[model samples]
Target: MSFDDVLQRGEDELLSTRPRHSLSWILASQFTASTVTAFSKLILTAFYNVELKGLNHLDNAFQYAKDNNRAILTIANHMSTCDDPMLFACLPWRYFFNYDDIRWGLAASNVCFTNKISSAFFSLGRILPCERFGRGPFQPSIDACIRLLSPDNSLNLQKFTLPPPILRNKPSWVHIFPEGFVCQLKSPHENSMRYFRWGTARLVLEPTIAPVVVPIFADGFEKIRPEEIDMKTDYLTPSNIGSTITVNIGKAIDDNVIKSFRDEWKNLCNKYPNKDNNDDLSDELKFGSEARDLRSRVCDYLREQVAQLRLQNGFKEEDPRFKDVNFWKRYTLSRGNSDPDIQFVGLNWAIKEYQRHVKLYNDKGEVIGEGKSERPSNL
Candidate 1:
């Protein structure tokens, strides 16, 4: 078998299990995270200057989660593929506001969980791998996310025995990028932070969960490594070293914000009685007008908060980069690094696996079962 086949088999095996972390694993991961943070501080301080601000906000948010037994849903802009690690490096783990370090996050399966090695690191970090797109009609990743955020029902004592109180009572801090994809900074809208997906807003309004939403404004990572630059080659190169990045945790969306959203949802529900059940409100719908309107309004409010934060962070709209689509390209070209070759080991491996799967299953243009009637093909 080819190396790609091996990676595919490993990826498949990892995704088969549900996402959960043992208490011992969580503690070990926290220790690793703390070590990474310390190393990042030391190296970045000596080589590339690092500045961390608005940590008090993170403290307050974590404190709130601890007090309320509620989960924390942090919505941040997706600036770079390494934002996850950057967040891990910058956030405090042990010293002050200690327990704030323990957190869980979602990572794209195709990109982040392609092979056993990467899977080990991400799983230890408490990351749940999600498929960006599934081959079949239904998306397993979306279903996993919904199940994760939805409330737990453990009414049956015999059927379900919850974990220990310490583990059970721990608040979940889920980090999400509402932008859906990494901002390429290729268009004006992308540069201005105008495009935001409705996933975060919908989760906030979920009746069963209704997690407190926190907006995070991140800056300067682009300076360290622009999207046009290759992640493996151009990022952190000699020329790009010593650049700075900032992550500012904003205040959580309080009760007033939730109340406003709830009021709007109620009004829309009253106007269109049957539309409350629909969740896909990305576009206007004739039948589900209430869900559509509520989604739009909630998304608008959230985006506005992010936009205000960008402005406050000194990202001027009149900047030439916003108007110039080839701004980063021009910068990269002028810097004399024209080699477009980039390599991401995990993503490349995952693509190879996906290709192999498609070739095997989709030879006849439509996917078909492979072996026998008695045992169905899992893929």
Candidate 2:
């Protein structure tokens, strides 16, 4: 299938085709992720001390979660594949910080659902797989997430009181990595943060659950696990096991900002709103430029927050490449080892090797399939 076909297939099939949730699988995955996190922390402590810079921000977030103030969306930078599990590991384990029913996230389909095993593992880990770099909107996945995080279904309306009763809806939180893909740590562009994809902006602006976005900046995971990490060469490799990670959790983006973005988006849509639900994608393409302007209003704001957090944490600002027309092309050319020729020459080999090591590709180099195809479940 062509890349466009793959993207269409994801929009059509990903959420619907997911396997039915198994309670046993969910519990096992949680236990395993927790264990792996514990091991990672143990290994990391020997190298560098773990420091959290913005405790007050986190404390306030915890309060929001406890009180069920609003749906929480934690947006963080994607520096390493280990980031998800590491976030859980670094924070104190509390009932409010539960991952099973309370927290969920979107995972890259290619990376997380390479096979039935991986699919089940990530699915149980509360990750909903979506096309990562594919062209089309990951519609089903996005809609599903919006539904999962809808305030009405996920939170207990009751106010917090002494000896808080077991919450009914579980008060959920969904984590998002706006950068879309993991950028190389040593890339020249590493001085500044990468531009965020507009999908997240769409999610936040579309209303289902207007989440309070909490921005987090993390550094040093790239140091601990190299950017070109492979299961065989680096997963078990201990070269930089002791590297320390610094996480700065900034204050939640103002609710008024969300409202403003919503207003801007609604105004844009009003100009050429979809009259029929049949061609959502076509309608978007027909008015692509306008759609982008609408998306940018939210995407830029979120990225600016992340960029500010990075600067506050001592990282220098690099050029904002997103403003350039050739940014992606430049980013591709930048990927490689120190030697430009060798980096280009060995790029395919390196990618294939990494895929093989991670079981994303079989021994014969065939892509692994996510279980059987099906339609997304109804909300």
Candidate 3:
């Protein structure tokens, strides 16, 4: 599809999100992504001392997902803009050959899709333009991720003359930066991670089939592209060439834990007074308070899972105060003046708070009611 088509249908409907792509686009995307991956591998090997631990866990999870027709969802903490592609460099070379077996990721729309050329480049690399600030996590792009994690049969492949191999009885692989933005601590020994956004909770809870959830922890990427860079160039140049980068791939979350959480979500929906009554309403509107609470809990649990990896990697225990969203808000506000990205974080938090108090809407373009603005007492 053309860029105009993506604009008209909305950023969420980009051809990259669909099950199939034009042959030319598929070829281009594969070539571009492969080349980039190869280059990243070379850079890491030649310049940095990279250590990857527990790679077997990822291999086992990928194999299990492929055998059982289940999707694999990988979550990691974001410390740099190039973390996704750069981290993949540690994988075996065979992974770079098949585009279907590789992972699809989300990127900030404002940063990655500002123009046609950049949009096409990132899209071809299998990145979806997600609205991080304006829509928060309730936008259609988040819904698309849920659809992707569902069973392969949910996709419509007949529309394309030649469906890509990714559409043929294989589950998609999706990667998410749950922290939502680059979060570099002043000291690498600090165990704290930013509060994971609720978008990730939806990915785990709403999928038709529970995905194989794997958590990854990486360090030293922040040195590659430090938040306080001296250069003002448009290109993403790597710095601190000889830093030691360690990547730890934790085991997949237990299946029983995922099932129990899904069951609890179902119970909440069933207990609601108006479950399934509003077919046109989004889950946020239909399930209302229950979804919001469940999402928060799920996000916290997921964040802790990643934090466990950080501890395993020899970092100190996280500070208890970092668990509170308000703490992060205040922290960001304090740093907003000097760091522009931190300013975006503060603004996004405000926008999310505002959205919570605004009028809710159904898919049919009808206003339902005002949302609750009260923060939880414990929080």
Candidate 4:
């Protein structure tokens, strides 16, 4: 298809026929959010060793768009409640939209009547909402989402689209955590991981507008506390123990790869029905396998594994990866490449696998407990 066709098709498949939440609503929400965000910004979000890596990928995305006049769409992991907010907060606000309009947009799941405060907070800036499945009338809601995302529709673009000078700016990025919410639960002993939705992947692939699908990895927002609500009070820093709360965004992922991964997942599920399929195969396994590259294979496997992880813990396999748990686990142990995908692969692997090892190595290499030799010959 032609370049414009990609955007057109994506819009046809994704946008709303008639927008919801009037233009007035969108503006008022932003107006209200500006005040709230202004206040929230003043409320310092304490930092505990947060590291940002692989931004070169996003930088490249911007540079590519500038050179080619194309756009980029990013799909990130929704492993923490703070995910969506952090993404907007972390981006170069002045580049994508008016710096003066950098406001926190809250889109609560139809909590308009029951949870007014949260609803307002999330539904603000260019606030777009995805239907809460089975909650109520959803077709209308889906249309609203599509309208905002449609290139022809200026409502979504007015806020998200950059100016000509801005277009030449960096890649226009708007983050969508397809998992929809955080991964961890309140209980300390529980080992369940939250599931991911394909909406993220679909947004990347079906849209001809953005050929690159960047994968963002979050290493630790799933910390378990004795009293979950008291996370602030019981905050045990990962870096203190040698692990850093890392946010690694991988290079733009090609659409073809997702096709193969999804195909493999579906094939495996159809072929082998009884196995415990959970994690998204690509992450749990590896990527580049189809490219005859082991590193890619390993990455694809790992992504798949993350899906199973969520599945095992009651969040049924949302992505197309629950068909082969072995492939996912094996990919985790497999040595990976230096590719940016490797970082996303490795980081998630650490979340499910290398956690204890991370705790042992700090700025200064201090072992958590001395070896048996240092134990003074017990008995």
Candidate 5:
């Protein structure tokens, strides 16, 4: 077999036991997750004046998902690198005891899996290394999430048969930062969030059963680990220790809404049956224009859900321009040239270079042209 065949075989085997860590790994992961949870609680309680609202909403969603054997997908904004594992500290202690009940999160592979030691550590913590700017949402890690959410559903990207029935029985929980980047606005009270990535849409559309979707809005984490910190040496150190961290958990998205959205996606797939197939490629890539349109729609709706939570918490409505990717790309590039924060200089440059070559698409999904000369008017 060719090298490509070997890689394909490996991926198949990995997905066969999707999200199920080995005995040793599970034990290690449980220990790591528990320790982190305890540490997070201590730090937040001791150093920060934490205000967590809507715990009952989270409790209701967790219980409903557990009772019905449904997968849970918790979506939140990414304000700082520590937004996760730290944000989860708000959950009650009972959540820490059951390893299965804990969340499996996606961390940027470039940042979290830079070396073998960090890779192993993060993996044991139930964190999946995702290629945020590389292979992107279509990579195997995203597929692993899909399989975990809906093992019975066969994806277009599947290269082998489904996993064992036993493995498919238990539903898992997944938490994603739909914004895909740590976005610190001009002020803490600013309600703006970056555009929701299409990966989040895949988590919702591809699942056989719609995962219970819960939106969370967190503020003050930006101060805990601001982007201005020196990425080289200050990673372990927390800044603004006494900053107030407010966490708000919104009610789960209504089941009927998710069902209707899935149905709409299904209709689109049926309308463009052959658009997702590739004869030369072993695994199908769902890059059809119709699929992209559906994904965009889903992402917009999901962003709105999170935005609503922000508004409910007394923040003003976000600027209409915040939903545009180009707007943020321009903003980042401009800041990279002037910002004194050296830590994010490289990241901002990468965004700048990416935007330079990015194509501009029209409403019909045609690439009308590429590259814009003018900056966004609001910027």
Candidate 6:
């Protein structure tokens, strides 16, 4: 069936089964232990020494948001199924510190129905059904986010438009995985990321607002069955010597690079903004493309770096796994062994440029997931 037809059915099905539930109420009731979760989540992020590169991008982003405190919208690349916990774990508090609400996550409608209990309590997925016309009916979360964000249509490029909901409210940060679902393919040949939906791109454009488009790529997160969220035993252990994951935060996307960005907001702002979107892509037809050349550059850069690490310095000094030809984790996940010529490259492609840092989450004194631990979880 055509994409439009599928979308129509999806929308129709969702509207018919529209579940009227209050997020605020659900969160308050389901997460009665939130006081417990807050402490745990905070300590894990703060002391863990989890550093983000290109964080200055968000630093500057926060400044732009100073006007009305319109919340920042972060677009992240989705890799693992269990990426949400890590998402909360990955970000620094300052990112969400200023706003009354920091974490706003979106999930495909399917996830809501499929895992209602979990989505309601622990890793609840907010259900939003999209129409073929790019509209969802009476979604409170979306409406609240849009209202809180107070998006100003004065900043967008033509092709991308922000929905009206974004303009009404002010949010600190809204985390969105535009891929729409979790990545669940196999490994050694893993990493067939779905194409990012343009909805996010449109949001960036329309709000006449430019949010910190934090492009993140997460590794080490795979299919997480609801039955196996127990980090104390099965999930948390070191899977494979080579089983390392990487999450990279790429540069932001802006109208400074798109002529359409300037044209859209020329009349709105007193100052005529500069429009020379620095794109690496040589697309002859598509205009105002900032991430146009992102794909080729990321691929090329990863391939070369990985190749160098394998052939030259080699990972033998740091990781002995690289010493054995059969122990291919280093070559596969390392920045030195990627080869573009080989179509079987893995997901490490998105994070090849990032430095991987690991900090242990010992429930030694802390309360682990769902009362498993005693030390308030974060320890």
lDDT of 3 by residue, 335-376 (tens): 444333323311233333322334455655355755554432
lDDT of 6: 0.39
Candidate 5: clashing pairs of residues = none
Q: Write the per-residue lDDT of candidate 6 for residues 90-203, one digit (tens) a residue.
A: 555554333234455565433342355654443333234221111222233343333324333432334333442121235446666654544443433344344444444333
Off by over 4 Å in 1: 1-24, 95-101, 133-161, 164-168, 186-191, 207-209, 231-239, 263-289, 318-379
Instruction: Report the C-alpha lDDT of model 1 over 141-238, residue by residue, as the tens digit.
Output: 33333333433341223422344112334445667776555654433333354245444554566433455677887866555556555545565553
lDDT of 2 by residue, 167-229 (tens): 224445778887766654444545345577777875686534467778998887766656454
Alpha carbon lDDT at 222, candidate 5 = 79
User: Residue 371, candidate 4: how far off, in angstroms?
Assistant: 54
What lDDT score is found at residue 223 in candidate 1?
Answer: 54
Cα RMSD for predicted model 6: 14.8
Off by over 4 Å in 3: 1-12, 15-20, 154-168, 188-191, 231-237, 273-287, 333-379
Candidate RMSDs in order? 10.8, 9.1, 8.1, 16.3, 7.7, 14.8
Worst 10 residues of 6 by lDDT: 278-287
* Most TM-score-accurate candidate: 3
The residue-by-residue lDDT of candidate 5 on 1-379, one tens digit each, is 0112222333463433334435665677789899888998888888888889999988999889877777899999888878978898977888878776878888876568777788777876777766544344566676667656753432333554445322323577889998877777564324368889888988897665678999999988878887666666777777898888889999999999888878887676555444334221122226777677778888899998988888877788787767776766666667644433323312442352333334444544355655542422221
Off by over 4 Å in 4: 1-47, 66-69, 92-120, 133-150, 153-172, 185-195, 222-227, 230-244, 255-379
lDDT to native, each model:
0.52, 0.59, 0.70, 0.38, 0.69, 0.39
Stretches off by above 4 angstroms in model 2 are 1-26, 65-69, 95-102, 153-168, 187-191, 228-231, 278-282, 285-287, 322-325, 333-379
TM-score of each: 0.65, 0.74, 0.79, 0.47, 0.79, 0.46
The TM-score measured for candidate 5 stands at 0.79
Compared with the true structure, model 6 gives a TM-score of 0.46
